[model samples]
Target chain A: MLPEALDAYVAAAREVGNPSSLHASGRHARRVVEEARERVAAALGCRPSEVVFTGGGTESDNLAVKGIFWARKSTSLSRTGVVVSAVEHHAVLEAADWLGKHEGAQVTTLPVNAAGKVDPARLGAVLEAYGEEIGVVSVQWANNEVGTVQPIAELAALANRYGVPFHTDAVQAAGQVPVDFAASGVAALTVTGHKLGGPIGVGALLLGRDVAATPLLHGGGHERDVRSGTVDTPGVAAFAVAVEITIKTQQEYAARVAALRDDLVKRVLSVVPDALYNGDPVDRLPGNAHFSFPGCEGDALLMLLDANGVGSSTGSACSAGIAQPSHVLLAMGADDDRARSSLRFTLGHTSTAADVDALIDALPAAVERSRRATAWKTPR
Target chain B: MSGGVDSAVAAARAHEAGHDVTGVHLALARNPQTFRTGARGCCTLEDSRDARRAADVIGIPFYVWDMADQFHDSVVDDFVAEYAAGRTPNPCLRCNEKIKFTAVLDRAVALGFDAVVTGHHARLGADGRLRRSVDNGKDQSYVLAVLTRAQLDRAVFPLGDSTKAQVREEAAVRGLAVADKPDSHDICFIADGDTKGFLAKRLGATPGDVVDARTGERVGTHEGAYAYTVGQRKGLDLRVPAADGRPRYVLSITPKTNTVTVGPREDLLVDEVTASKAIWHGAATPIECDVQLRAHGEVVPAVVTVEGGTLRARLLTPARGVAAGQAIVAYQRDAAGGDAVLGSATITAAARTSVAPEAARA
Candidate 1:
């Protein structure tokens, strides 16, 4: 977290009182929380009343997915359809899966293009077929794995025509791109801290004033009674500060990180000619570079790179710390071999040219050794 | 590392020896449970976490390689098929041959690792010969004998010189959390230690008859012939006993007829054994040596001969309870101390010699 955000957090943490309490200290705590909520609202282009604080990105996604589905389905038993893009984070994918398994939800997973994009026409076709039954449609503003920026406005507009609630997990897009909750034409938008240089365990579900979502937690009627928990006052304060600071400088940060990321991709590709750069080349996130090294296992490559002091990931490490073939890549039409051979390198706000240089210096040997490892045949 | 003290200490020793060490735990289960509800089984989520913790303490990079597909195809499938064919296959031996040596070792070498280090208690001599560990009770040479000479060349056994107790002591001293972890026993994938139950789940129950080998009369019934191993005495559930009032041992299992043959204990004895797919580590025959029939079974003196990729061994002493699919590892007793591993083959058949043994004559 940035120093300014940390200061706000530490200051808020030292004060005593519940935001819900009625005493003097309680009122004081309530004022601090309300002010933080307004700052977050102003930063994200949403109303303070629309911003409902929750634990983080995962929690916000669950609320928007399950809560919206439940509320819509409850009002009309026919609204049993839940549509989501195949490239969504597990938090959203698994939430849709749960509803399908237990709540009689018919989940229609919209496939993405080779670039990992959800075409608006695909959503329109699904809505045209089952618009009345479809309770909600969710496509992430930007993918967490491949960093493909979706045309959220077009998608939300399409869903709006069908009278279906549209939600976006904007956790990865908030500070890296222009995210205006009010202008996005979605009923709900998910944002989190940590990703925007704020503290962990604090985020917001920006629900449209007219959007009806059932409460996931029920106690003391907090956050418009849609989510109930003792407010994380300090985390909220820090998150708002992070939001204010990051939005103010989003363009400059994006440009700088994008430049470094470009340099990394260029140099890495030059050294390994056959390596395929993954995701949407033109519409990718500023700070992300993904690649599929032919004949290399992503996990082995990641370990070799880590040993060389260059930390990277095989896109996603599952619960067992075993790297499964990337679902996003598979959805993007890559073969199983290509999917398992991919690696994701993320350049954060703190990254610099030197960091890119370190990666470039380490890539060739790591890739070569990894390829050799994959080429080994068992003598069975 | 298997979330056990021996592997933890082995990793520690290798790191301390100044080699760039990387700790790896194989995720051999397709759907590993979040935690082990029972004390048995490896490859649980808990085991992965334990391995990660050990890596953290050792200050080395760690990874869990998903070898589940390979393990399932090569080891688990082969085990079931062997049992279905009425042979008592050792999963550990199969695992060592396929997973630890072939799959994992090949991957390690490809990744630029000089060798794949394991915690098995068997020594690789400077002469490039594999020898029994000084700790006789824990020697794993029998299971490891399936590995070819090339696989052995790339394998390192750091814990071979230390006893199990010494390994635990070293682990405690190194502050590895798995210091007190109990040793894994039986078939690791069989979480409940019920071989019959595990096989029944996969192969299903095929009703068969148990026959008295002496009289060739049906004496009992079995759920599946695969459930009984040669030389098994208990759990026969026999309907009738010997007229002399003695217990019957499982003489043989014939999957073709779905019959488990049981008879007097003397009927189980055999002096001649034949094995197929012989893998010679370094030693050749016909040579006089000692042969170990089971994982920890005592070694009996024998003259072993090889021809047509099959090995024939004549035991100097009559052996009992020898089973097909068990590895017969031949070892030459070194004048210095520990016995050196010579070769191994999977026993294909066991039979009584054409002539009566000296013990029977006496």
Candidate 2:
């Protein structure tokens, strides 16, 4: 947590008032929440009315995908299908899946190229094939696992041209890249707090006023009736401060973080010669470096590095605690074996040259041990 | 853990003993959610949930490791091939021999754990050799006898000192919901307990003759000769009553001719049994030991000898229902009611005392 955000959160949390109440303290609490919402809206280049507060990135994404799909249903039944990129976070993918399974909606997941980037032109092809049936198209601005930035501008423009709403889960790109909802021409964009520098459990979906989104939750009618329940006052305040500071310093922070990430990737690859870089080389998040080690299992390598105090991920862990092969790698045409042998090291605000040096120092022996564990174990 | 009271109590005991413990339930089924007919059963999603909840009550980390591919290749496929070769294979022994003791134990060690713990009703003595459980009625040393010395050294069974009733009581005390869970029986992969149907679907249903070994007369026809076990009497479906007014029993199965040889019950008694794929815990040859033919089956007082990589046991009293491809675990006498396991071998053939040895050949 950032010091300023932490201090503000602590100070605000000491007070007691529900932002939805009509009393004096409640009106003051409502003012604090509205100020936070306005700051978030201005920072992301959207109107204050466009910001719909929710629990976090996941909730915001669920609302945009499912809510938008439902709203489209009210206007037209023939156009009730959802088209999402293949590498979406499980949040959006699963929401669309639920809409398909239980809510009677058709879903089409678009494929990605070898670099983990969706070709913007594919939207034209999909529109031509299933135009009236395609309700909305969702493509993440930048992937969370591989950090491959998609061509969101062209993709969103294509969706708009086809009179379909476009939604982007910009949780990974909000603070790391320049994200402007109005400029990107997207109907809905999702952003969260903790991914950058804010507290968790507070985020907003930038919903265009012209875009229709039915409520995911009902009661008391919050966030233009798109999301329900009382707004989180302290959480929103801290989230606003984090968003303001991150965007203000994004250029400098990105430059320093990307350099450290690049150095870490280059030196580590040099040490482990068989390591392969994932995602797009030129177009990627400044703080993300993902790799596939030829003979090592991702979890084994992660544990080895974690023991050395270097934090990493083998894609994302599900509820079962099983470290499955990354779907992002498979979407890029990697085989199951290759997909299973992946690791992602993400740089953040606190990353430094010393951290990269530490990773480079500890990677060789860890790679050796991980390879020794799984190299012969794959034949079965 | 097998997601029963035994393993749950074993993990709790290990934790109580101040050992850093992590409970791992092996996902043996390709799809764990596939429940068997009737009640909750082995390797189903329900078992995994019970195992996880048991770990939660015990306050230890729990994980489910998917061992389906390893199990299919080692235990399940080997079982099919063995039965098709006219041998009645024990799938549990194969699981203990290949999957649990070898694959899972090796991975547990590689993952930096000291030992693998289970609910097998077998004890590891202070001498580090495996002995029969104190609960003689539920002793599991027969199936576990296939484990080598190193595997025994790294294996722990906390239920060895307690009876099944006591284990269930301990589980109840620990607030485990599966305390009264019924014990899982039969081959886990055979969901319906119909070994014949499961194998028929895999090996195909081929009709064969059930013949009288003594008279060389065909008595009944069977869908598959491999489906019959030695000493089985009820399912023979004989065409006529025996000449001596006695019931017939399956003496041997010959896969090549698809023939099942049946005769009077005496033919099923074998005083001499030969085995292969021999594994020993101590010396290669168990000098004088009690050999058990089946899991939870009788222990035959026998003299064991090994020559040219083959094991032969000469029983002082003939052993009944001895079948090929089953483990013959060797045990030695101890102060306890049951003997201590010395080693084990897979049965290749068995011989009755009076019959011409050539006639015993299927």
Candidate 3:
């Protein structure tokens, strides 16, 4: 799968053309970019013009959030605040926080349910009360850690009612679920390449024609001037191919990945009886499983699995090498012990049933060893 | 359970003892931003990962406990307060007494565990008595002396009988990731080994005068008395030198007066010290035993007499520079190759010695 994406990337890299240039070579480059854009739009069910290229997921999120917020606030002094869900990715949440701290922007973070999903009704009430103050309402399409899929359509509908621009970070949900940008009624949507088996360092911010966005990076007038930078032609081409393939095979892939995830959950729980499964069981992502074993540490489990040739994730990969507990878990109301005891196993295009089997086979012994090494004795 | 060889072995021993064991690595750091970009220490992200790896090798359930707030309140706050009061404090002692044995143990009990175990190099006798470990050079009884009876009852120290080398060998044998993990020293919170700097950062320096006891003259200017400990010598830039051309040692720190007193080495020695907040491990009454005033100091012979809530201990031999706020751990010889800890007390005061020419001969 990786080879295929690389092949497309290599072919695109050989061509020399600037999508924005008017020369013959530039026109050729423009064709390649346009073709990729059309493919991505077709997959996401949005107009080709709506797809705006950015550096990556983080940049895309920044552009969508800060862009819309500034644009709305510029129109009216009353629209000076940004409302976002509590569990948003740092790209959205931290940007809002930075704006609040440095740019005099007020931010109201809506709460999430036990499953890490936000309620549209609660959001609507918040909008009714502070709608004039709210410039933009942002919620993630899905949570990266727990894999909880939020009700984006309902949230967008409510935001639309208040004439507030709604943005969703669909970075994790783009290929895993059916994300129709038009049907969702969101002003802006974020999707990244790497999450969908595409090349890294490339993603897009889908902006509706009516949506107004202020450019973050100022340079050459690329990405319709909403995001100014040299276009990553190869990365964009690979991403387009990956998105097209992912969308075509999404249903079958979801079925297979969900089966493996469920199997893993069953096997892990069976071996470690007191394991606490995190996130929404049914409404979660198809290929993600998060569990907290009462006595085991997440890092210990991850290492144990790694030793046996199985790879997994714990908390955010950004803070990869650290032994710190996940803020996401903490924000979801997990106590210190529970938050520390958790591990996340995410499946991708290359994951298979055998991989799940290997994990199950190595689990019991690893858990036993980890428990012994820690000598963690809880009082009866 | 798994990070270091000792903890790994301790977990193995507990499991061998037939108890349902689980490994836990506490995440005491509040934010990853506070961690040194690349450093190793307990509660640091790297150490936690190493610990987790060890737990996995041992096949135990592993967890990270978020004790950031608790750590700040207990260890960090206590350390700052101890320094502010013109005393040197051991943060490891406070962490063991508060977080590890108490908070972690309480949570373990609530989770239906039989006991909380650690790799502390201290022993529990057959009669369930707390004693020094077999390896005298590696004995860690002083830091653990602050544990109460209730805490000791639910605690297990598995590395008590084993040497550091043996623990490493066992970790290698078990294929633990932290088999060769370096032993972490220095204050965990002060990642750069700058205790004085840490104190200064926490407590702003209050300018004070360093005075000579004999001449009654201001010899040097110091940032604060609290910054200087009882025996520190090199950092004091004194303009006046001793008659013998020896460096002046910090004899006393008076936070109330905001003055630091410097004198000869002999002036720092004291024959008697009074300790408050005495904790007797097993016995209800105070007993005479050898006491170690510092973590690495010699165990000098002393007679402990309790009156009300305070303990007055008179050293049979002259001990040097016994500072207030140091722990005086009492130890009695046991049949099992080492001494058993009787109790401990925090030194509240050191009695001034009046020089007597004839009495020194006696």
lDDT of 3: 0.82
- Could you tell me every candidate's TM-score relative to the true structure? 0.95, 0.86, 0.66
How accurate locally is residue A255 in candidate 3, as Cα lDDT from 0 to 100?
Answer: 92
Top-TM-score structure, candidate number:
1
Q: Give the TM-score (vs. native) of candidate 2.
A: 0.86
* Reference-based lDDT, residue B167, model 1: 89
Best-first order by lDDT: 1, 2, 3
- Scored against the true structure, residue A6 in model 2 reaches a CA lDDT of 86
The segments of candidate 1 whose C-alpha lies over 4 angstroms from its true place after superposition are A376-380, B33-39, B205-209, B283-286, B306-308, B334-337, B354-362
Compose the digit string of candidate 1's lDDT tens values, residues B1-362.
88777778888888999999999999998877543544467787777888889989988889999888899999899999999999999999999999988888888887889898888998987888888888889999889988888999998899888888898888889999999888888688887788889999999999999999888888889999999988899888988877788899999999899999998877877889999999875455699999999889878999999887799999988788999999999999974657888889999999996545654653
lDDT of 3 by residue, B291-320 (tens): 899888888887877666577888776677
Model 2: per-residue Cα lDDT at residue A148: 96
lDDT for each candidate structure: 0.90, 0.85, 0.82
* Share of reference contacts found in each model: 0.79, 0.15, 0.03
Best by DockQ: 1
Clashing pairs in 2: none
lDDT of 1 by residue, A13-116 (tens): 99998999999999999999999999999999999999999999999999999999999999999899999999999999999999999999999999999999
lDDT of 2 by residue, A46-88 (tens): 9999999889999989999999898888888887789999999
